[model samples]
Target: MYKILKKQKWSDTIYSNWIEAPFVAKAAQPGQFIILITNQKGERIPLTIADSNAKEGWVQIVYQVVGASTLELSLMNEGDSLYAFVGPLGIPSEVENFGGKVLIIGGGIGIAPIHPIAKKLKELGNYVVSIIGARTKDLIIMEDKMREASNELHIATDDGTYGQKGFVTNIMDDILKKESEAIKDIWAIGPPIMMKMCTRVANEHNKQIWVSLNSIMVDGTGMCGACRVSVGGKTKFACVDGPEFRGNLVNFDEMMLRQKQYCDQEREALMLLEEKIRRQASNG
Candidate 1:
């Protein structure tokens, strides 16, 4: 059993946890993920590695209480033990200089995964510029952390609640226009729609972005066909091949459809869990 060393509730739905998984923490890189099982009855779920400390024997994971398994996980507290924690899986992000500066684009929870990437890139002698966004200011996350990781940090919100009133892409365009010569690599991780849009913008400027497909993963292994994605007209599994890929070569339209394939089933599972919790509370 993997022990939960610490847990912090970021909001009503989002939580950050540090689990005692020394091996996984030692092997984890910027873009790799972990598969977590809440209990024997719980389904497997993939979560990005938000942070890690190999020497300290801990790996951090930031997750939102989005579905049934996550709701179940949220009920647990610090010092609780997890049924299973398998990882430092998937390909790590390329953390080279890229001959110049690089751009890091993270949206909502995407910022969690991007935080380590930003820190790594900066450590590797690359000037890191990051832009993070959410629907509104209250939804913005990791502002202080990203700021520390990046040489320059920018924020955007759909509403004018925080940094910029427009989307992150707006600032992306402005930066690329001004420093197209210095910026050679881009990493964008977020909701599918946001990634698709960022990819489109990058392509227009004759550039490509690396995007993480963590949202589509199920088994966190090639055995599950659920995470199949088309990249450069070839079949690829997001788990074994990558949770990160060249955004320009990916077929986001098909990916978007595949993401919704199990919505009804997932909704049903969540409802059942909620009802069960209610019954337990009433019984108590």
Candidate 2:
């Protein structure tokens, strides 16, 4: 069992956890992920290794409580032990000096995994521009860290609650217009729709683009076949082959539809839980 060394609530439903997994931490690399099981009967969930201190034997993971399992995970506190923790899975992000300005784009909770990539890119002597956005200001996370890793940081909100009044792509367009020649590559992580938009923008400017995909991953290893995604007209597993892929060749629409297959059931579960809580409160 791996212990939860610490936990911090980042936003209303987002959390940062420091887990004690010395072996996993020592082997972790940027862009890799871990599969964790909260309890004996719980389903395994894959989460990116946001940061790690190998020497300290701790791995940090940031997650949003978006589903039943994630919500249960949020209820865990410091000193709690996880049933199973296995990892450092998935291919690491390709890090090198590509000799041109790079733009890193992340939307909502996707910023959690993009942080390490942006940090490594800047360290390699490339000018990194970061763009992050959410529905509103309160939902935006890791702003300070992203800013420190970037030469320029642009923020946006769907509701105009902070920074620019539109999507991150709006600011991206403005930046591309002025620095199109200087930008050599773009890396984006987010909801499928957001990634699709970023890929489209990059394609318009003929810039090389990379995207990290989060599909249904049952096991961190490729054997499960749960995280398979279509890329370049071929089958690729997101767990082993990549959480990262060339954005231009990915089939975002198909992935998006696949992700939504259980949306209605998920919504019903949440509603039922809320009703149960209400009944308990009323009885009290």
Candidate 3:
């Protein structure tokens, strides 16, 4: 069992965790993920490797408590142990000196994974500009960390509660108008819809954009075939081939459809867990 070193609530539904995972921490790189199981009977879920400290023997993961497994995880605290932790999985982000400006776009909890990528790009001598957004102020996350990792940061919210009133796309459009030729590469990680929109914007400018797919993954290894995605007219498993791919070449509609495959079952499971929680509360 892997021990949880620390845990903190980042927002009403989001939580940050630090786990004592020496092996994974040592091998982890920006953009890779970990597959974790909460308990013996819990379903395996893949979480991005937000950050890691090899010497300290810890890896950071930030997730939204949206489902049964995550809700149960939210109730656990420091010193708690996890049933299984397997990772540093998937391919690492392709980091290199692009010799020009780099744009990193993140939406909602997606900001967590972008943090490490932005940090690494900056270290490789690229001028990193980060554009992040959420539905409102309450959901905007990882602002401080993104700021430290990037040379400049722009924020957007649908409600106008903070930063620009529109979406991150608005900011990206403005920047592209002035700096399109200067931008060497773009990396965006977010909800599927958000990534699709970002890909559209990049395509308009003829800019190459790399997107991380939140495809439904059953096994971290390639054997399951559950995380397959179509890119450039070929089937590629997000588990092995990528969670990241060239945005313009990916079929977002199909990927989005695949993501919703378990929604009904997920809702049922969540309802059952909620009822169980209520029963325990009443008994207590």
* Candidate-wise lDDT, in order: 0.90, 0.89, 0.93
Q: Rank the candidates by lDDT, best first.
A: 3, 1, 2
Evaluate candidate 1 by giving its C-alpha RMSD to the native, one decimal.
1.2
| 180 Cα displacement, candidate 1 (Å) | 1.4
Q: Which candidate should be chosen as best, given lDDT against the real structure?
A: 3
Q: What would the per-residue lDDT of candidate 1 be over residues 1-284, giving only the tens digit for each residue?
A: 58999998887788889999999989999999999998888888899999999999899998888889999999999989999999998999988877679999999888899999999999998899999998888778888999999999999999989999989899999998888778989999898999999998898888878999964666787777779999999989998888999999999999999989889999999999999999999999
Tell me model 2's lDDT, rounded to 2 decimals: 0.89
lDDT per residue for candidate 3 within 1-284, as digits (tens), equals: 57999998988999999999999999999989999988898999899989999999999999999889899889888999999999998999998999989999999999999999999999999999999999999898889999999999999999999999998888998999999999999999999999999999999999999999878888879998999999999999998898789999999999999989999999999999999999999999
What tens-digit string does per-residue lDDT give for candidate 2 at 1-284?
58999999989998999999999999988788998999987888889888888999999999998877787789899999999999899999998898978999989988888888899999999999999999899989999999998999999999999989889888888899899999878888888899999899888888778999889888768887878889999999999999899999999988888888789887876677667768988999
The TM-scores, one per candidate, come to 0.97, 0.94, 0.99
Off by over 4 Å in 3: none
Whichever of 1 and 3 has more TM-score, that candidate is 3
Question: Model 1 clash pairs?
Answer: none
What is the total number of backbone clashes in candidate 1?
A: 0
Winning candidate number (TM-score): 3
Steric overlap count per candidate: 0, 0, 0
